[model samples]
Target chain A: MDLSLIIMQLFSGIALAAVLVITALGLTIVFGMLGVVNFAHGALFMIGAYAGLYLASLTGSFWWGLLLAPVLVGAFGMLIEFVLVRRLYGRSIDDPLLLTFGLSYILVEGVRIVFGSDGIPFPTPPQLIGVVDLGVGFFPKYRLFVIALVAVVLLVLWLMLERTRVGLIVRAGARDPQIMRVLGVDIGKVWLAIFGLGVGLAALGGVLAGPMRSVNPEMGTLVLAEAFVVTVIGGLGSIVGAVVAGLMVGICISMVALFAPEMATIVMFALMAAVLLVRPQGLFGLKGRA
Target chain B: MPVYETKSRPAGLSRRKAMMAMSAGVAALAMPRLGRAADDTIRIGFPTPLTGPFAAEARDQVKCAELAVKLVNDKGGIGGRKVELLVRDDKLNAGEAATRTLELIEKDKVHAVVGALSSAVQLAVNEVTRARGVIYVSISQSDTINEVKDFSKFTFHEALNPHMTTAAVARQTLKKGMKVAHLVADYAYGHEMLRGFKRAQASIGAESVGEILHPFGAADYSTFMPRLMSMRPDVLCISNFGRDQANAIKQAVDFGIKQQMKIVVPVILHNQRLAVGADVFEGVVGGANYYWGLETQNKTAAEFNKAFRTANGGAIPTDYGAYGYSGVGSLLQAMQVAGGTDTEKVVAALEGLQYDLTKGPQHYRKCDHQSVQSVLVLESKKKSAMANENDLFAIVANDPGADEMLRSCSELGHAT
Candidate 1:
C-alpha cells in the first residue's frame, strides 16, 4: 500500500527476474542449437550446487566454490554425454529426454543418500550480509550482487558466441549440421562444446542459488518446472526470447504474489500456456524450429 | 494393520475381567510372561524416523531412551531383567511404520513398542500393536492418535496430545485478549490443533475469522501472508512444520505482514529458528513440550539436556528427547515393578504408574497415559531482550495435566 513497500517489492521482483533469466539461458541455448530437449538440465543444476558446497567446505573458500561449481557440474554433464547421451545422438529425439529424466531421479536420490536427507545452511559471505541502501529504496546486497553477476555472465556469454570462430561454427551447425559437415566442420566437438556450455549455465544458476536458498539435496527439483516453462515461453532456441520471457515470468510471479500469493507458481504455468496459445514457436522462435 | 493373530490371553482381562484385575491384582500377579529371554533381556521396539525430517528430534528421543534404559538397569534392571532397545527405521512413512511394527512384534518378539514422531505412522503402528495385544507408547503429539484411533488395551500415550498442547496455547493467547485465525498444515495434527484452538478461542471469548490450510513442505508463504493480514486477526495460529514454518514467517517479515499481525504458532517449530536465523524468529509465540534451557530441579532432565547437547553437536528439541526417554523409562519401571517379564502385571503396573521425570519434577498421568507436566511456552527472543544465546525463551506457561485436557482411553472408545 505504501510507496516504500511497493518499491521494495518491485526490486525483489527484479532480483528474482535476474535469477530466472540466467537459469533459462542454459536450456534455451541447448534447445536452440541441438534440436533435442534436455530433461536432465535441472539435475545438472543440482549437482553444481552440491559440488560447490562439497568443494567449498573442503577448501574453505566461497569464491572457489563459486568458480569450480560450474566446472565440476559441466564435467559431470560431459561424462553423462559420453557414457549415455552419446548413444542417443543418431536415435529418436525422445530417447534423450527419457534417458535424462531417468538420470534426474538417480542424481537426486544419489545426492540425498550421499548428503543425508536434510537441508544444510549455505550462507552468503559476510561482506554481502546487509541491506544495500538505494536512495528511495533498499535491497539485500547479495541478491543485488547476484543480479549484477549474472548480467555480466550473460554479456560474456553473448560475446563468446558472437565474436568468436567457435560461435560462427556453432551458429552454422544450429542452421544445418549436414551443411556444416559438408563444409568440413568437426560436428562431434561442437556437440560436446554445446552440451558442456548448457551444463555450465545450469551450474552457474546453481552456484548463484546456493546463498539465496537452502542448499538442500532437492533444491534444484523445486525450480525445475519453472525453468522448463521459461524455456518454452522464450522459444526453445531463442536466447533473446529466453531472456525476456524469464524476466517476464519472474516479475509476473512476484506481482501475482502481491494479490493471489498461492497462485503465483500457477501464474508462471498459465503464462506459458498463454504464450503457446498465441505463438506455438514462442515469442522469438522460428516456425521451422518447431 | 497386520494381524499376526497370536492367541489372546485366554482368561481375558476383558473389561469385566479388567475391572476385576484393577482391584484384586491376584490373577494379574499370576499371569504368565509371554516373551522372556535367558539373558533376562526384555526388548522394547522403537519404531522411529532415523533418516528423514524426524531424525533430529527422533535421535534425541532415542538417546534419552538409551539413557533411561541405562538408568533403569543401573538401579537394578527392570524386574531384574536387562532392557534391550530394538530400533527400526520407519522412514517416517505410515506404511513403512506398520510393516516395521509387525517385524518388531512378530520377528523380533519385542514385548513393548515406542514410536517417535509421524502421526500417521504412529496411528498405523498403534493398530498393529493393539492386534498383537502388546504395549504401545506413541511419542507423536497428534490428538487423533489418542482420540480417534481404537487404542488397544495395551496402548499408552507417553506425551501430551495435540488437544492438550493447542488448548493450553489457545487459552494463553486468548487470555491476553487476541482474536485468532488458524494457519495449519493440511493434515491430522493441523486439523486437531485448529479444533482445540477453536474450542479454546470460544472459551476465552475470542472469535475465529477463518482457517487457511497450507500445503506441507511449502517453499514460500506469500499467499498465506496476505490472507493472514487481510483477515486482520490479532493472532495467526500456525501449526505448520519445518520448512513451511520458516518460509511462512520469513515471507511475512519480507512482505511486511509481521508488523501488521501477531503470529502464534500453536506447536513449536523445531530446528527452524536456527535455519531462519534467531533474529528472524523473534517474538513469535509457540508451545514446546520441553526446552533445552528449562533450568528445572529435575537433575536427570538437566543432565540429559547437557548430555544431548554434548553428543548432538547442536541445540536439541527437549520435547522429542523427553518423550523418547520417558517412553522407554516408563516401560522399564513397569517391568521392574512386575518383578519379571510378566505382561499382564507389567501392563497393570504401568496402567496407573507415573515416572519421576528426570527432566522435571512431574508425573505422567496414568489416566490417559499422557504426560502431565510443564510446557515451554515462549515468544522468540528479540535481540534487545536477549540475556544470553540459550536464554531465548520466556517461559509463558507450564503444561496442564493430561486427564484435564486430553480425551481419555475410555472416552476414545475401545479397540479390544
Candidate 2:
C-alpha cells in the first residue's frame, strides 16, 4: 500500500471517529450517572440536525442555526425529561427502554411531519465548504473542521465534568446519591439536570453533525443501533473509554474495508464481540455495572 | 393506526367474486362488493408511506395516483368502469407496509392493489399478494422484486427494473466511445443498477476505473469529489436517485469536475431541476423513462400535471408521477382488456402486454415483467434567470421502445 494512501485512509478514519466519539460521549454521560439508557438519543440527533437545518433556512445563516439548534434541542430534551422520562426513573430497566422505544417512533414521525420525509439541506458552512489541500493530499475542510471542533468540545466537556462545581455534584451523585439526598441535595432536581445535561450533549452532537449527514427523520434510528454497539464495546458509562473505543472502532473498520469493502459493517460487530469475550463489561467498565 | 398488514385478507368470497364474476353476483348480492363493477367504480388501493421518512415521495406518488385516476375517469372511464382510489398510509417501513397491504387487500377488497413506492416496500407486499392471490402492481423499480424466489402470480409492475437503464446506458456509453468511467452509486439501489451497468460494460469490452460507495443520506461530496476528479474518466456515471443526485451535482460543480468530464446520472432526480437552480446542473446528461416536459397531446398528461401542480404547488418528478400513472393505468387497461377484474387474466395480460401511455408507447415484457419503454436521454440546458423552472433538459436522444434487459421468468426468483 502507498504511504500517501495509508495517510489518506487515516484521515478519513479519524474524521469518522470524531462523529463516533461525539455520539458515544453523549451516551456515556447519560449511562454513567443516571443509569438510564436513553434509546431515543439517535432520534434526538436526527431532530437536532433537522432543527439546525430549519433554523438555517429561517435565518439564512448556517452558523447561527448550528449554535441555536443544540440549545433548542437541549430544551426539547429537558421537556422530554420532565414530561415523559421523569416517570421512568426509579422503575425497572425495561421501562425507560420501552418508553423510549415508543418515543423514538413519535419523534421520528413528528420530525417527518415538520420537515417533510425527505432529507433536508444542511449545507456546509461557507468557512468549511470546500476541500483544503494538505501538503500531502487533499482533505475536505468540513471533515477537518469536524475533527477539530469535536476535539474542542470533548476538552470542554472533560473540563466541565472534572473541574466545575456542578460536575463535582454530578460525579458525587453518581457514586452516592443517597448520601447526597440525606444531606438535603434535592436529588430529584439533580437527576433531572443530569438527564437534561446528557441529552443536551446528544443534541449538541447532532447540531455539529448536520453538515456531515443528511437531516432525515430516520437517519438517527440507523445510528442509534450502532451507538449501542459502540457503548457496549467501549465500556458503558466511561467517557474516556467511549472516546478511545470510538476511534479504535473507526480505524478497525477503515483498515478492514481496504481488503473487503462489504465487511466494513461486520468488522465493527465482530470487534465488539471480541471485546465482550475478553472483558464482559467492556474496555473500561466497572465489574459491578456489568 | 389500523395496522393493516398484507396477510389480513383470507381470500374471501369478495376476492373470489372479484376474480370470477365480472359484475353479477358480487355487485347484485350487495355483500359489500369490495371490487366495484363497471359504471359503479373500480377501487384501486394504494398502500403508501404517509407518516415516515418516505412521506414526501410517497405523498407525491399518492397525489399522482389520484391524478391518474382523475384523468382516466374524466377523459372517459377505463372500459366504462370509474376508477376509485382507496389510499392508506403505510408509514414507509417494510413491516408496516406489509401489515397495511393486508388491511387494504382484505378490508377494501380493491379490484387491484397499488403498492408502496420503495423497492423494499414492494418486496414485502409481494409476499402478501402471492399468498392472498391478489393482483398487485407496484411503482418500485427494484428488479429483484420481479425475480423474488417466490414469484407472486398476482403481482405486476409498470416500473422498469434498474437493470434496463443500466444496460441501456452502458451500451450507449460504449457506442459513444466513452470507455473508462467512475461509478458513484447510492448503496442498494445503486448497487443493483451497478450490477447491470457492470455486466453491460463487460460485454462492450470496457471497465470502470473505480467504484465509490456512499450511504443514502451523505451530504458532503467533497470527499468523493477528489476521487472523481483524480480518476478523470471520459464519463462519470453516477447511480444516484432523488435528492442525492442534486446534492452530488452541486458538490461536483463546486469541485470543478463537470467542467472536465462528461457527467451521466441515472434515475433523474424528480423535481431536482426545481430544487437546485438549473444553472448549476446545466450540461449534465441523465436518463428517464418519462419526462413531463415531453410534448404530448394526451389529455391524461395535461390533466394529471394540472391537478398535480394545483395540489403540490411544485414540479412533480417523472419518477413518482409516472410510476403512479403507469401503476393505475396499466392495471385498469389490463382489466379492460380482460373484460373483467380477474387477477389471473390481468396478470396474464400484464405479463406480455403493449399499451399507449402518456408517453408515446410502452411494452411490458413477459420475461422479467419489466417495462420496455422509451428511455429519455436528456441534457441539462442552460436556463435564463427570468425562468421559473430549475432545469431544462434538452432531449438528446429518444431510445426507441425496445427489449429492456430482463431476467427470464424462471431465472427470476418470482414466486406466485
The interface RMSD value for candidate 2 stands at 4.4
* Tens digits of per-residue lDDT for model 2, B364-406: 6665566767766777777762243533666666676775356
Clashes of 2: 18
**lDDT for model 1, on a 0 to 1 scale?**
0.73
lDDT of 2 by residue, A1-290 (tens): 55665566667677767877887777777888878888999998887777777888889998877788877887878788889888877889789888888888899888766756676545677787666667656676777887998899889988988999878888899888899998878878877777777666677667777666555677787577667778888899988889888898877766665544445667788999999999999999988796
Each candidate structure's TM-score, on Cα atoms with residue i matched to residue i, is 0.76, 0.83
What are the chain A TM-scores for all the models, listed individually? 0.96, 0.96
Give me the candidate number with maximum lDDT: 1
In CAPRI terms, model 1 is classed as incorrect
Weakest 10 consecutive residues of candidate 1 chain A by summed lDDT:
A130-139
| Candidate 1 residue lDDT tens string, B67-119 | 77776767767656677888889988989999999988887778889875878
DockQ result, candidate 2:
0.26
